[model samples]
Target: MSAPLAAVPALTAPKAPKKLRSETVALDSGLTVVAVRKPGVPLVEARLRVPFLSAKAAHPARANLLAEALPTGAGGYDRAGLAAAVQALGGDISVSVDADRLAVSGNVLATNLRALLDLVAALLVEPAYARPEVATERARLVERLGMARARPGVVASEALARRMWGAHPYSLDLPDGDAVAAVTQAQLHATHRDLVRPAGATLVLVGDLPTARLVEQAGAALADWTGSPAARRVPALPASPGGPLLVLDRPGSVQTSVRYGAPAVPRSDPGFPALQLANLIFGGYFSSRWTENIREDKGYTYGPHSRVDHHTLGSTLALDVEVATEVTAPALLETHYELGRIATLPVTEAEVESVRQYAIGTLALSTATQAGLASTLSALAAFDLGLDWIAGQPKRLLATTVDEVSAAAARFFAPTAFTSVVVGDAATIAAPLAALGPVER
Candidate 1:
């Protein structure tokens, strides 16, 4: 009863174009300011990055405590007063402490940028380091550390870091419950004086405001900020003590969490970009080998992937996935097989194009807002990269060849050096996984 219909061509949507440009200004005080000017936006985001944090300090948690404590009360304002002032001015301030850096950042309306900058400078240079606030925050951190220990994923990650880096400070677990309880206000103050030095730190400002004006304001705001001469040094990460499997037993787990990876290139490694692209093809995306093999084809887990954890001193290629307990071993095997495939087989031209498109397309999304642009610029400055680095990303990603990707995969993904971490019933899976490599209890 139906007439034959002619086949219609499929309509394809045009790819979205990329738009965004950034500029960087180097301040006289060794501070680097980066900014992006966008049309029709009247907001500015400024972030100040101090290079030393938990990893570089004599007492790491002290830096952690100070970051939280600084914003509570500074200059002549009490904790409540500071909060009210920021709220009334329609601005927000936050402090973040990570392994390699501590950042005090804020967002403000373009009209109120100067006041916000003044407030941030006071927090940094004129903090009273109120002992009462320090005691309160330290108590909260101790409680948080206790909660983290009960988390399976947290336990697995911290264990992996410890195993991978041994005694390196980077591997130091964030203060445990007992360690946090032992930290004192005096120690926090001493740690602040030692690591948060101007010579080793950099101030990064990113926003749409005039660069010259911001630099001038920063100079006046932070003029008296000085620190005792000291250089922070991190112990070298030992070569991955590659061996067998290590598993942490989370007895009641219905789903097994797995992390398998090995040491890879650092941020400064010349092969960083190539390795980054190569990883994108392997497991860095939703359509990558690990996803297709471990999830789609085998149905072992929801999804699986890998990332290059680019640290200041070193980096790692980490693959993580969650699967049913019964399928954990097979899923890990599939992960390793996928890793080897990129090196052993020639990658298809189609796959290369697909990944290149994905990488560049996603990057454009990352710079969509003023805050986003500022964050990107801050990262570039932290890595000592130039403004052109952003513009060159698309070209570099597209120019990678199959041969180059294969070589990069081979150089970075070594199955022998691959360390496996399974957070589930070690009693149930340990014997089977041990056959793959030596089993570390």
Candidate 2:
């Protein structure tokens, strides 16, 4: 039998959500804490970000090594012992490292938040970079580095960073092989002491719990944690470290990987929302013009993407695409065409609304889960922002006009502003690329 039709309700624009109430506290030990009370769920999610600035350090890969070895054991617990303990608590924790920080994140029953937190304290305070463990991790890192060197994407990305940052530590993503081999247990220990300090670091927690309870427990658990301040100084970037095409020559390669980007505004900028929407309308999503032009029409690549990546010091708008070597030049030309069009032409209100809704929907979905909200809050804290900053995103994006999107596009998305690199068979694509513009060997 056919179901009876229900009352049809007319659609309307979504109203502003109730403000999210969150607390930010600077602990006496200098660790920052951002806590939001989400009461529906019974799980607690937490993240710890300790900035890793290895520019002046002896071994830039030491943090990377620590990320692997930390999980083996700490504070009188072996690998098996630690795993058993976490399992007993009905919780799990993991560690990872990036250009900026080492992230220690985990989830647990809301009632067991304090227990998991204590384990975290132990791991960070007395991380066991034991010799045997370090050697095993070093072997793994070496193997991974060798594999990354062979991958065209990694090769091109590393080359671009080296050209942009010069001798800055940031330029080196995978540590030099010799440097990785040279990292000693003592060095790892010292690096942790100097860089893993609570000062300027953040600890974010989100879940169903009283704000006061979570704050008090966190303060007590991390009370004894202390160390030297993390080094965080913005490096002096070149006036223009982009433009010339650097090719990562891979002989006999069947495809070329294209990377395009330049330094751009940070998230806190007033024009950020509009710029973000502009990126979306251009290539940040599947429905973007860049994707439609290159993937749907021209059949140049499987997917093309662009994003604004942020760090402690600066931000960048990066675009990436991979196409067959035969079509590399044509693909590059079309990409430029799309960039020029976006920068020069005004976007329609319909396009603006589509991107705005997508942006808002994404933000809402990101904070819909306890773990998601925790990580989101943690990333925001790195920029000295809180929930309020994210709470108003829908409004900011909604208020943005098509003209504003066009202005942002012109200012930041101009094709000429980009410095690009292509990784593929230079012998095949070099001539075509040179015809388009200057090509550096």
Candidate 3:
């Protein structure tokens, strides 16, 4: 008790630099393939990305149906046969339909890579889109819609997408129970024929496989797949018309869910890196401006952050925060203030450095795994970026000047263009929020 002890400073280790190994293969069929052969893992992941999806196709919903229907039966095998084959090989295949693309992916042991590729080839080249399976899946989608409506978060997100995109086909809602009920087997087949094609698709494989063998196997498996002339370019979305704050009333919500943002740059935009850095300083990290001001300082809620969603249709910056219902207006006001501050003020050198380090370090950590590497390539393919984008990242990130960050903030973080979405008791916070902008009650 009589002796005073000096405190020891905690040791912080420096982050290790990232090593990225990747190769891009261009197939004679015009399918671009990207692969990453990392050591220490015995598993391989293959991702096939097609740029055409529900939004661009004649019947957008069919894109999703066709993607789902493919793995159910292909290469003369029924749904059960395909399932048994994958299970026996100790592998799994899944499909996802996004606004800009459709992805079919599989993970298998290294030894079974050839078999997995054969399975994927059959799925892509020989889907039956059977009527019975289409009806069953349609019923399942109807159930999913019903379940989605019951979740406040899902409802808010769906509503936000609709409000942001307006009449754009991308805004096409996930079909509701009634809409699902209306979908027919013939419609599914017709959509499949229109959207899933060779001209607008990419194939990616990542794992510890020889490049030569992979190319040979993939070529033979996918050679028969054919389609019409690919679309020269992706459709553009109109600027999000900035307007009133939209508040969806969800009764008994203990926490007020918020989504506030507007259109931002696409992945291919020159300002992409700068905007990414600027957004990190704003709310992309745990210790960002939004978190420091809105949560740490005021104790408004648990956390807040923002992201740039790069999609085939377009891109947008999203600021998401959840707070107690009573403090919703204050939280929103603080968020807007922080956004405006980034543009108007010159960020301190320390803040700028911190964000850059955080972003670069995260990138390194993300590409450390085979699956992670494949995912990175898939995103690049979707954005039409080159294979060298990863290698070129350091120069671009380090080259970001404070002035560029400020300019990016000014260009993309305009508060006037932001659309506010709150899922809470509209009766409680509606009036207070309207004073800041028009209210879409």
Candidate 4:
């Protein structure tokens, strides 16, 4: 009834990354600027990273509000006027904050690169956290945080963060809504003054301009944006003391959200390439073993994924999945089984080859565009890594062997290494899940 399947073609090894034309410069005000010349489109992309980590109890709420309002008004322009100015110069800019850093990112026509940098300098030197704008953004932030906290996935993630990091700033990924409501415009102004500065910050520029010229434009425009931020580096992430699973009761929930977290190596680590491939083969890709077992064979969840997330302070291997509430226990059992299997067993040569190609290919694809390269460079700058590190990744992946990947898997992917959280109807799933291991209610 059906024709025989055609033989799949063998995959070709990815070509080596071409050498990049780039330069790094330290400006007078203690800012680090990385400029790369990537020609294709007539656009330039810019990213600025300011170290924004803080352990103070009220810092998260203040930082969130500051990110929201920083670009809304700056220099002499109101929100609308600033938008108009950027549009006139064929550019756009936005600001975002996280536990590690405050980042400003945007793109502009290559011809307007200097103009966009000037606008960025305006935001840095003279952000107008005006009363009206702060009030508006604050109200909106509270509403968004409320909605996010209400979602099962967000709840599970927040719970996992707390369980893994304890009282660390990393535990406070989302600020409390009441804290946000209490923030004042003066507080946001103070936050900007205290944290948003040039020292220990990096600006990445990628576009059609010559690398040297891009650095010159950035330096010239940002000369007035001076001063070092206070010493606010986030402390080292605490080791995840993997213990009992946290089970939070969400009445009448039809689906269970399962989240797991464990500490992992940074990209600069020697074992990172091996761990990266092992992670992908385990659950990080569509055709991964966990996906095949849980989603394809058992139909427990639509998709189960694992990834290694890099932050300025540390890296974490995270697992996330959602399954029917009734199947929560079985889904978790299957997850644990997959983790144990990968950790204890030797990965096949074929498996290593497949994920190696995949890892190298994805790295190439992620940095192929002007905007993508700019963002990648900005993220890497946190660890003082640069284009050379990126260009050498393929060689690392290719050289990684089955034994090395298996070793990384055994070290990092042990089921007992993870601290997990499950959010669903506790009455229905608790006893079954406890049958597997200890669960804290």
Top TM-score hit = 4
lDDT of 1 by residue, 1-441 (tens): 999998975434224444544445555555555555553477777777778634443456666677778788878988998999888778999998877777877888877877887788778666767878878887888788888888777777787777888878777657556666676777766666666655545555555666665566666777666664355556777887766678888876887888776888854455666788788888899888778888789999887778988666678898878888877778777777877787678777777777777778777788667677667666666677644676677666667677776788888776776776779987677777776657777
Please write out the lDDT profile of model 4 over residues 80-195, one tens digit for every residue.
99999999998999999998899999999999999999999999999999999999999999999999999999999999999999999999889999999999999988888888
* Stretch of 10 with least lDDT, candidate 4: 228-237
Which RMSD values do the candidates have, in order? Answer: 3.0, 2.8, 3.1, 1.4
- Give lDDT: candidate 2, residue 290: 95
* Backbone clashes under 3 angstroms, per model: 1, 1, 1, 0
In terms of lDDT, which candidate is strongest? 4
What TM-score do all the candidates reach, one by one? Answer: 0.91, 0.95, 0.90, 0.98
Prediction 3 global C-alpha lDDT: 0.76
Report lDDT (CA) for all predictions.
0.73, 0.85, 0.76, 0.93
Q: Which ten residues in a row have the lowest lDDT in candidate 2?
A: 231-240
Residue 98 local lDDT, model 1: 70
Rank by lDDT (best first): 4, 2, 3, 1
Query: Where does candidate 2 clash, by residue pair?
Result: 243-419
Where model 3 places Cα greater than 4 Å from the true spot, the runs are: 1-23, 54-58, 229-235
Residue 13: error of model 4 in Å? 2.2
Off by over 4 Å in 2: 1-11, 230-234
Pairs that clash in candidate 3: 54-60
